[model samples]
Target: MSWGLAVLQHALRQPGCPLCRLQREAEARYLENLLWENVNDPATREQWAAGLGFCARHAWQLQRLEARRYGDGLGNAILYEDLLQRVIPVLEAMAREPAMDPLPLHRRLAHVLRLPRSGDPEGIPGLQGRARCRVCRLGEETARAYAEWLVEGLGDAEVRARYAASDGLCLPHLRMTLICARTRAPQALADLAGDAVRRLQRLLGALREYIRKHDWNYRHEPMSPEERRSWIRVVAFFVGEGEGDGSLDDRGG
Candidate 1:
């Protein structure tokens, strides 16, 4: 099979890839080091304070990591200026938005505040003790990355094909995906959604055939362990596969 096909299978089988894993670890380390350096250096500290501080989720992640590596709350205090500079603008902008149903907005903000502090044996209190969910943060980031990758890598044709093959995304992910593509041409966005729908239809048919031919039980299959494993590998290969051309590397900023 082509490298592209191989990637599809891998994605379906293993949701995370080595590149993504390395990137996450590297990002974590970089952020950690930045925090450490800022503590000792006034110039670096000022720059960080001027820039947007970590989003709620990232802040929690950093907090957790710091607590694990060093048990003091000292590091967090150094970030006070950074937090004030970054978060104040967001709060100000939010204040200016026209009034609507406040519940959803309230919930989202509350969620951010409630995010768990890293390494807290008992979860950190949310706005008022509600726990902020990390899963949503991770999902949004991953979806954003994927959407950005797709926009950059695949042409209209390939994008359509992949969309069709994909399982309809969860609502939250769908929103994130759409946001990622917000800068693209409207025609391109429509093409992508249309193609994905078509691919999904075809995939459903193929799955049905495979199930019938194998007489596989959904709940309890009769296949040998090796056979089952092989089948799973095949599925992962197809679903996770990416186009092999260096196109992915060349696409957008």
Candidate 2:
């Protein structure tokens, strides 16, 4: 088996969503690689410039991982210093530009009321980073590729069994997996879909049990582990794994 698939199969034995876990690992790997090897590479810097040095989540993640892993923030400093240098000049130029006079009160009221704008109002300034975050892009590409692999992999009984042993794919990953399976391998999509449905049923049941047990009538009943985590697990599945949450290490990071 390919290394990724092997790793994915192993992940099937673990908790939470495999796709989410792998995606986080993929992003962390990219960030770690950047800090260790490519922080100063011209092409890497060019990509960073285009993205304006990462999205806020990843920008800080880069710094945090740099400090946590390396005991320093030198790499982040280099990247942001370059970005700040590019931005300060733009800010200074904006400061130098003549400011337009405020609109009349009636015109301001009109603008607020959604009438035509006045004074040739300009857009927010400074360099617009049209390029999406490289880390986000990589995460997406990795997830989709994994989704495809998962659908294709499901053809094997062993692979399907391995999948059945876990919490199954998240909604986003399931959609991507279904899409890939529909176009490329339609035979086994139902299995993955059924798995998702059954998992959802259990998740819903756990959530309901959790709510029921919260009532004073049922408060004496013991909470199962699944019941305990169903609320956050539901949120994780809905919002995706690491999109906003933080983490640390191979399991999360």
Candidate 3:
């Protein structure tokens, strides 16, 4: 099997949404790789600078991962310090902007008519970077690749059966898969959609059983493990599987 197909198949054997699990693992691996190897690489540093460091989620995630896994913050410190060094000049320029624009309306017009500000700072890059977060881009591209793989892989009866046996793709990934299916693998749409419908039906049954068991009279009845977690699964379906995943914004700022 292709590596991606193997990844999808293996993910299906695990708990929760396969795509979400893959994304989380992918992000961890990426950060670990950076900390273990690339933190000081010139090309890596250039990417960090362009990204202005990670988005809030990943910036903190880096720290958390470092502390929890390696108990060493050296790589994170180096990265943040470098990013800060690059960032200071931008904020300083933005701070200087108000002073440069201090002219009254008539004066500003006159100055504009004369010439552009002589010492305007080179494109004042901001905290709000035009560049997408490196981590976020990796997450997105990673998710997209896996989504396409899932959709196309479903063509195999064995892959389809494996997908059906698992918690299945989360809603966001379902959409991504559908998009991929609509264009590239129209035949697989039914396979994925049918699997989704079946899973949703199962969740609905479990949730209803869970709710019924909450009634005063039925409260004494024991709940199945599935029923107990049904509502949470529903919520996860709508909101995604993890923290900082609410938005599908490409820039992830």
Residue-level lDDT of model 2, residues 1-253, one tens digit each, is: 9876888887777766788778888989999999999989998988887777788888889988988898998988898898787666555545565373334432433343322333333433334453779998898899888887787789889999999987677788888788889876767787877788898999999999999999999999999877887777787777676544431122321
lDDT of 1: 0.46
Candidate 2, poorest ten consecutive residues by summed lDDT:
244-253
Off by over 4 Å in 2: 98-127, 243-253
- Per-residue lDDT of model 3, residues 106-197, tens digit only: 23432433212322234432443446688888887888999988887888999988887887778998888899899778779988888789
At residue 177, candidate 1 shows an lDDT of 49
Counted clashes in each candidate structure: 18, 0, 0
* CA-RMSD of model 1: 13.1
Give the residue spans of candidate 1 off by over 4 A: 1-30, 41-44, 47-56, 71-74, 80-146, 156-188, 194-253
Worst 10 residues of 1 by lDDT: 244-253
- Backbone-clash count (model 3): 0
What TM value does model 2 have? 0.84
The lDDT for every candidate, in the order shown, is: 0.46, 0.75, 0.76
TM-score of each: 0.35, 0.84, 0.80
